[model samples]
Target: MLSPTLITVALAAAMIGALAGVLGTFLVLRGQSLLGDVIAHASLPGVVAGFLISGERGFVPILAGALVSGALAGLSVQLLRRGAGVKSDAALGSVLSLFFALGVVLLTVAQSQGGSAGLTMFLFGQAASVLRADLLPMAVVGGTVLLVLVLLWKEFQLVAFDREAARAQGLPVERLEVLLTLLTAVTIVLGLSLAGVVLMVALLIAPAVAARQWVRGLAPMVWLAALIGALAGSGGAVISAMGQGVATGPVMVLAAVALTALSLLLAPERGLVARWRRQGAARQALRGRQVLAALRGLEGDHATPDYASDEAMLQAYLGTDAGPALARLYRDGLIRPAARLAPEAAARRWELTEAGRLRVEEGGQHA
Candidate 1:
């Protein structure tokens, strides 16, 4: 039996996560991941102003203000990049610091004036405070963002992967870039109540980063990221409900980070573990080939078809450990004990099989 409040909070957080995940994919692909952080910080002033103007912690006013503030911050970065020739990183940093400072000052002023009791909740978020009334508007905004993304998928993809190429292809790269930025800002605003200003960027970025590890294509990556984000959001909400005085935003961020770590360690083609295994396998295969070629060379030089080399001889010839390679080659039937070929005299020496000789001659390995 779950309370309606918890259900509502979970739903709200899930929607926020899904939206952030989808939009954040583009941000991540465009190498503008820090843009989410900039928007999150810049939206803070708007959040405080929205509360001040409404005289209440209403979701609509706060989100609307945050959207405007975030969009302005995005535009400011562009303007600085284009007009003042400031680097994108510098512009983003400047806007984030400026807006966050203004937000802190406004928050202090609102605190002094006194109707701003729960206003600070937006800083770190209070998902427990979410009401059912917040769901409809969040759904509407999230749905619209998703619809726009669906409609402009290809164009966005093009702009994301290659802006110059998109421009050369006669696409409206600038307009598309601005639209993507707006979508990112809107998504960040939607998550503000769930992940808050401080941790919202993590929610936006972590799912996409994790998703990237598991997928190579953009569409699949976006879908997987949304799923991961939703899971993190709902799971965090449930966990927070189970504990006393636990904040939902931080929990959600931690969940997302955990998912990212798992993806980094476990993804088949791209994970650290997978890459390490592949590299080890490649090194082993190279060593096997080297040992085979060395045996073949030794036979050619000595005019003997069956040249048996001991582990020490192979190690000296290869200038590295040869035990693993020898074991692997023996397992693969590419090499065998020299005693099998010469029962008369042998001191645990190895010789290349016909397959190994053919592999070396062909300059390739067996599948």
Candidate 2:
């Protein structure tokens, strides 16, 4: 029995997630990931500045202020890059610190004026406070952001993968780069407006990272990231509704955290656990092959016939590293061990069963 408000909040969160994912993918692939974080954190001061000037709390003017400030932060980083020798990371860090510091100062000033409880909400975002009125803006902006992202996909890929080539191809590398920065800023600001600057980066980044693990192409990545974002948002909204005083922003972030961890361990090729397992399997196969070659050497059987001679030859080839794996292989019918042949164990060589040869071929494909 979820409320309509909770459902709307979740829908909004999912849209935001999709927008973040779309631009976030490009940011990460282009190695500008930290910039997104910088922009997200930097937007707080803009929000406070907006509130100070407009004397209000809702998204309209505040988000406008956020966009202005966000763009400035993005532009400042670019100016730093062009005007000074400061590297991108340093420039981004400098902007983040300066903007956030300014925000804190503005917030302090605004709080001194009157009831600060309402003003403080922007600092950590009160997503559960979101109403149906907020839906149209999120939908409008989110839709525009995604449409532009898809239309410019090819250009972005070139710039991200090979800047020099994009330049050589006359793809407006520099312009597109700035345009991307602005998009990243906008996307970040959207999340910051809901999740607060502190957790904004998670919303903008986690879904994209998770999506990357699942897809090879850009389109699927964006879609998947959006789905995850929406799910997290909706789930957080539900949690907040049932629990007394549960913060919506933090709950959304926690849901994102779960997805991020799941992707890191379970997502296809790029997952942490998957890679580790692949490496372990590869190492075992290599050792098994070495043992087979060694067995052939000890066999003195020029043609190296079959599985009957493995027991005696295990001593010559199989060692501590392969003992457990080899034993498992034996039980699985991949290999026949020489262990049963005691005397003249040199002739007691292991032989590859059909499964072992297929494994070897599979290894060759990888090579």
- Tens digits of per-residue lDDT for model 2, 45-109: 78877777888776777788888888889888988987787898889889999998988888889
Model 1 misplaced regions, further than 4 Å: 340-346, 365-367
Please provide, for model 1 over 19-58, each residue's C-alpha lDDT reduced to its tens digit, 9 standing for 90 to 100: 8888889989999899999999999999999988988888
Relative to the true structure, candidate 1 has a C-alpha RMSD (angstroms) of: 2.1
Among all candidates shown, the one with the greatest lDDT: 1
Question: For candidate 1, what is the TM-score?
Answer: 0.94
Ten consecutive residues with minimal summed lDDT in candidate 1?
A: 339-348
Alpha-carbon lDDT, every model: 0.88, 0.75
| TM-scores, all models, native as reference | 0.94, 0.85
Number of backbone clashes in candidate 1: 0
